[model samples]
Every structure is written in structure tokens, then in C-alpha cells.
Target: MRSYTADYVIVGAGTAGCVLANRLTEDPNIKVILVEAGERDRHPFIHVPAGFVRLLDHPTVTWRYHTQADAETSGRAILFPRGRGLGGSSAINGLLYVRPFAEDIDSWEQSGANGWNFGNCLPFYRRSETWTEGSSPQRGTHGPIQVSRVENPPEICGAVVQAAQKAGLQFVDDPNSDTRGPSIWYYQQTRDGRRRSSAARGYLRPAMGRSNLTVVTGLQVSRLEMNGTHVSGINGTTSADIPVQIRATREVILSAGVIGTPRLLEMSGIGDKDVLDNAGIKTRIALPGVGNNLQDHYVVRLGYRVRGAGTANERSHGLALAREMMRYVVSGTGVLTYSAAIVGGFAQTRLATRPDVQFVIAPGSFVAGRIGVLESEPGVSCGVWQMRPQSRGHVHLTSSEITAAPTIAPSYLSTELDRNTMVEGLKIGRRIFAQPEVARYIVDETVPGRQAETDEALLQYVRDNGSTVYHAVGTCRMGDDAMSVVDSEMRVRGTTGLRIVDGSVMPSITSTNTNATVLMLAERAADMIRLPMAEHAASTYSKESV
Candidate 1:
């Protein structure tokens, strides 16, 4: 096995990994190494905003995982696509730039995530953002990641926004600024014109020129090399069919995301004893919480056919298609430059204190269940998702080998509370479409149709057809509880020189898109690691002089 060493060895080059790599390597004295299981983010589809449908399932860029046959959905297996490239899912996601409410961060602090309240985290969020619109005191001007509003909002999107207002919802200029009640706003995307502003493009690519940082692609980390209780290095296979060991002198950070991080821990004998035993691996820590607490937002799409001369369906096909493609190629401004969902609204399910559901308004049809080509349609589509679900699940190791995929049990709709919330979400969605201005454009409800009236019927429909919004988190949660896998500082419990810095560390799901929060967490984690050392040295000298 080829051996290597660095001050920090970060696993997974996704969103958090890229941010951590950039921040940690800023100090020239600290050498950082990042390992990614997938290849470089070089695919053309990954850059285009509308090309996410293709990149979502591309085996080269995504780890296309499927859940075990779910009991809630008539034993149907669900597809879970996660990014495997330099920018991670940020490169292939829907590109909706949203930060959850200040209350959501306060809830994290209440859940034992100390020093993670809104006030403490706001600065980090601002520090990592470089908004294209303009600089704000609340937003960063020199950050790597780019955040911008859509240049052109489709007519259907505007109608939906107006419909939301007609349905008693407020219109907000920036949803990210105030995330309270139901409010319609233009989507903030990670795009520079038609090109995606993923972490690879934002941070990693710029940091690649640094000699102190080394990035290895196609390196699937199998296990953590441990010496007693201390993590020494990572043992994995290189792209060239060679085994390798990379030692970390200071720390071994796992930025492998929710699924990959937990699986790696299980393979290293740090998971449930029964699971480890079944996989024929001797238990090292017997931590049952290592893979527990899986949470994700489930969405149900509502499609409608519209009557119009100029629409996304009209432009996606025939001669108009060629013209639109030419327009995009020439000026990078067209329907192809925006994400599938151009406008969205965040609202509370009930008369709650915080918003717990989001409505995504797309001018085009999203035919493919998980992520596929949009079907031909002149109508608009709206997807309603319940955020902050009360239900939780687990990820278990199917085998001890790295090549083997894990068994994912999301347990969607497992709780009665979650079911009730989803029913409310559906009701709220229908109300928005029923408004006079928005109602004129709708032809029919293609999804639930007119049959979904009663709450029980909608709940049944949700159990039968609900799908994840691709926001899975809280598996390797950070807290001080006995079941916590990592502490508030992201240090792995019952282990030394080990930490988890990804969405997996989130104790609960955010009220909005997870990418922005994950980036902020990594930014804060980098500072946490650096600030202590600086303070310690200064204190040591003062004490010695005294």
C-alpha cells in the first residue's frame, strides 16, 4: 500500500469537504488532503442549470443509492441520488439557495448543538456567500460561493407567486433574509449565468493551486486506520487498483456526507453491534447511534396543463427548442439558465411559530420520479414538501466490504405527526392553486386529481407516492447526548483525532435547502479548529511569564 501523510485528511470532496479543504489549507503551515470517491466535476451537464435532471442520475457524478423496499410505500424501493464529485451534491442539486429560519438555528442549539444558534452562525453564513446581486452587511462579498437571483422568472412562476399572494401569503424580496410565514420570492441559485457555482467551482478549483493541498479523486475510503482509540489515517483503494494509506498528523475529518460517512463508520466497526456482527466485522465501538436518526424532506408534485402561446413546453420542443438552445449558447440567458423550480414559497403548515413547509413552483413538467428528463407538457408544476419532519430512520451496513452498498431505511411517514403535517401541506398547496389569478392558468390537477379531498385520503396518497426532496441529514448527529455520534465541535465521540463535518452532523433538518447550511457549518468548523490553538498559545505564554 502506498503511504501518505498530511496535517488533515478530509474524506469526501462534496460541499462541506471543499469548504473545509479551502479554509484549513489557508494556513500555509497546515497540509490538507481531500479524497473523493468520484471523478472530477468536468461534465457539461453539471454546469448548466437545467441539466441537473441528467446529472442527477449520471453514475459518474452521483452515487445512485436505492432504499430498501419501504413498508410505508407498498414495498417500493426509492432512489437516493447524492453527488460524488468535487462540489458534491451542490454540483447536481436543484441549486435553490436557501437558509433556514433563525429559529431553526436556535432549535439546533436547543438540541445540544452549542454555539450554533442563529447569532453565532449568521456571520459564518455571511462569510461563505458572495451574492451576485450585491454586497450586504448580512452577506459576504469576498466568499467563493456565488448566490444570485434568477434573471428571468417564467410567466407561470410569476402567476404562482401572485396566486400565493392571492391565497393570503406575503411577497418577500428575499426569503433568505426573513424565513417566517408563507411568502413567495424569486429563487436564489448558485449560478453564474448558465454555469453552476458549485463548491468545486467556488472553492476547490481556486484552492487547487496551493502546494500545501493535495486532492485525490476516485479514492473510495473503506475504513479509518486506528491505533487504539486514536484515528491514525484512512485506508482505501485508489483509482489505479492500488491500496493506499493516508496518515493525518492532526485530524481525520469525515466530510463524506450523510450516507457515505455513516457507512464508512460501520465498515470501521463503529456502528451497532448487531449490524457489525451481521456483516462479519468485529465491533470496535458498538455505537448504535452511528447510523440512526436519518431524516429527509418528502415532496409530492402537483402538475397542471396550461393554455398559452409562450411556455416552457412550447420552447422545449420543435423549432423553438433550437432557437432557445442557440440563445443560450450565444448569450447564456434563457430557460436553460434557471433551475427546474424558478420560484418558491415558504410557509407554516398550521398557525405555528415557524414555517415548516415549502412550495416550489416550476414552469415546466418534472416527469421523472427522482431525477429524469422532463416530459412534454405546456402546463406548470408545483411541489409541496414538509420541512422539519418528526420521523427518523437508520442506515445499516449490508456488508463489511467498501464496494457493497448499505441498506437505507428512511422510514418515511413512519410517524403520525409527519402524516398530519403532509396532509396540511397538500391542503395549503391546493389553496394556492385555487386562487382566482392562478386558477385561470390551471387546466387540471394531474397528480392527486380531484379525488384528494379529505385529510385521510391525502394522508393515504402521501404514504403511497411521497418522495424525498434529496435533503437527508442528522444520521451522524452532533450533540452531547449519549446517542450523539459527534460533539458540538464536530469531534467524534469515544474517539481521538476524528471529526465529522457535513450535513450528517446536523442534529435536525433545516427549514430550507441544506447546501447553504452545510457550507456555513464547514466554515464555522474551520474557525473553531484554528481559534483554539491561537488562544492556547497566547494563554500559555502569559502563564509562563507570571
Candidate 2:
């Protein structure tokens, strides 16, 4: 029966939600409430750089949703793991930081996001990062997120780099400098020393003590309270399952991610009329775009057993694990300090003008049947993914029950473009691994082995083994089109005092890991939200300062 109020009510304390909370609450006059479905990100593993392996599918810190059995996936249901709690997916994501190219943002501008060109987006990207490599004209200096350079580079990684060069790929200073290239580079990690610099840690945690911001965890929002199409407040249940209402005096922003955002919209009766009707709920808005245009990067791993190399597989057991633990405890640099993939490159398949495939090479392999568990012996892996997949699927409510996870289908390899590109990508990986510098380390090909050599076999391998790179987007696509759920500025269509600032707002997915892009988006959104408030506050400033 109790209700709460704030100038802004952010629905999820994930990447976007945390940024909004930190920026909006800068003004003491603005009261902000951040509601999260997971607990505070205090788990020890959440902070350790290499702790991502343990965090993936972690019941405590993740929303372990499973996709409806995708036919393209050999009828196997893929695990759709999303982060819960303060940092959201950023907390559990591999600490890889990649700035998307200006061309990528310009494409968004071309596609309908009017003011979101590379020129417009570059500032936000720079504003959100404090690159430890020092201030470059292209990189940021005094930003919240700390991007540490890869140090104590592993020899295997160097060999892989050499192999990429031997294959005629160029090594670039910045991956985001250009989109299509066969360039090898060290992963930019969002970390400082040994600790992970998740959005929660970088943005939200520092702002938690602010009087204007209130962050509540374990509050699973149920629905949006609408009055004549305007979102008046949100109805949710606390950790104790106590019903509560939180009203926003200014706006209600949904940063619940690509999956959670659209599902929450439909649950609140803000989606297609037919979808609402099927769910037995009256439609508040007939916006057909909600929960549609689902997209993701599907990757297939080519595992190779290693003989004379130190791989992460070995680091997970025996003296190797103990030594790394001690190394991290002392200096925070070791085998456990690297990103998800050690060295990745963007290469063009002969089928394309630009780089369509991303080669993610990791100095480790996973055991068969165990998704995240590392192999017992030394091994390496190269996961090839189509950066820009043409296949489109969707997320929709299955039942009226809030506890039920939405029906998610990424439609991986459903199109000719996706299928062909994946095959070419797999070939690219094989080529890179076959280079003499890198080939010497390989003992044998284990995954999809030498047997799956033909193009048809490769396609089948992708269908049976390809899974999400965890970069899901476009469900609440931002555009001027009728199919778009939100506009260029992230304002939800046909809704008042409501907006979505997350990866879901991306009109198209970026070529690399999405955290950097998401942060940039949220940073710009924060400025937009506070610009008017800042102007209003400016009037109250002393005349001398002005």
C-alpha cells in the first residue's frame, strides 16, 4: 500500500541505469530512484578481472533465461544469461572494451538517429572512458570507466598476433579507428589493477551516498502505471514480495536491457495490439515494433589442443591455479587477468566489402558438454562470429505470469548472409591458426575437428555449436521508422514521460562488444536529460559566476 516518489525512477541499475542515476543526481534538486532485480555486486568474483568465467550463468548475479528451442540451433535451447543487480550485464560481462567506429555511429545517423553520427557519438565515448594508456586525441583521459592496457602479454597471444600479421592482417593502434580490417590488437579491459571497473563500481557505487539518489535492489518491477498513455509510476514487488508503487515526477527511464526492456513494455500493455490480445491483456498502445527485431552475434568455437603452451585450461587446476591466485593477490597480473578472448581481429570474408567476421582467439578451451568449464589439458580456442548478422528474431511474452521468462529466439544462421558469412569466418580462423607461427603450438583440432572440413559441414557445425556472443540488441530499436519502438533520442514511441536507454535502443548492433557503446549512449542520454535542468539551475547561480 506504500508508494514512493522521485524526480526520475530508473527501472534497472545496470549499465545505462547506473549512468543515469549518477549523472541525474548530480543536481541536489533531482531525486532519483534506481530499482534492480538482483542484489548489490559485492561478490568477490565480481571484482576480480578473470572472475567473469565464474560469473557467467552465476545464479546469484545473473538472470539465467533460456531461449525457446531455436530450430537453427539444431533444436537446442541456448542459455541466455543476463546480469542482475547493480552493474547488470556489465558486471558479469567479459571486461573487453571496444569503441565502435565513427562509421558505425554514422550509420545510425543515416538509419534515423539524426544527431547520433560518429562526430556526435565520439565525444560521449571519450567522455565515458579514462584510458590508462594516457590521453590520446581519440581516447579519453578523466572519465569514470578505467580502461587498462594489457600488460605482461602472454607469449601465445604474441604468437597469435604474429600469425595474424603473417596472414597479411594489419595491426592498428585502435580497433575502433576503422571498422573493416584484419588488425590484431590487445583487448582494452575496463579494469584498474586487479579489480573490475563495472558500471556499478565506476558510476553507481560512488553515487550511492548521494542524498538525491536511492538505489534499491531485489525490486522486480511488475508493470507501468499509465494514465491516458502517460507513465505515472511503476508497480513492482520488493525482495520480500511486498507490493510497492514508485512514482516519477519527471520521467521513468527503462534501462532493463534488450530482453528486459521490451518484455516489460509488453507486460505494461505498451506493445502491439495483437500481442496484448494473445496474452489476454488490453493493449494500451498498438506499437507493433515492441519486442521485435531481435539481433545478436552467434559464434562457433574451433578448439585446438596445445602441447608446448600455457593455456587458461591449465591455469584452472593444480599449481598453475595456485600460482596465479598468489600472483593476483600480490600484483594483480597473471593468466587470470586477461579478457574473455586474448586477441581478436576483424577480417573481411571474400563475400563482403567490409570486415564481416570477428575472430576471437582465446588461449584456452572448454571441456565438451560443459559450457564455461575449462579443459583439463592445455588448449586454445578461436571463436568466429558474423559481426553484422542479417538474421532477425524476437522476444515476446509467453504468459501473463511475471515469473515466466520471455520467449527469446535470436534466429541464428537463419539467413543466407548469416550462414555464408559464418562459413567464411570459420575459414578465416582456420587460416590464421594454420599460419606456421601459430600452428606449431596446436597439437590437434578438437572441436568440429578435421572431419568437419567442407563448407556444408562447417555450416552444420555453426548450426549445432554457434551460440550468443552476449551482444543482444535491437528489440527496442531506435529510429524514425514505424517499426521502431523508440526515437533517436531514446524516447519510447507513443508514450509520455518514458524512455529506454540501453543496448535495446541501438538501431543496429555495433561490430564489437557493446558495453562501450552502451556506456556512450547512456552518457549522452544523461547530458540530454540534465541539459534543461542544468539551464534551469544556471538561472539560480550567482551573477558573478555567469
- Candidate 1 structure quality by residue, lDDT tens digits, 66-182: 887877766778878899888999989988889988888898889888888999998899988888767675777778888889886766677788888988789999877754576
Total backbone collisions, model 2: 0
Model 1: how far residue 207 lies from native, Å:
0.3
lDDT of 2 by residue, 71-121 (tens): 788999988879998999999888989876567778888888888887888
Best by lDDT: 2
TM-score of candidate 2 on Cα atoms, chains taken together: 0.96
- Model 2, global lDDT: 0.85
Which predicted model would earn the best TM-score?
2
Runs with alpha carbons beyond 4 Å of true place in candidate 2: 177-180, 369-371, 535-546
Local distance difference test scores for all models: 0.83, 0.85
Clashing pairs in 2: none
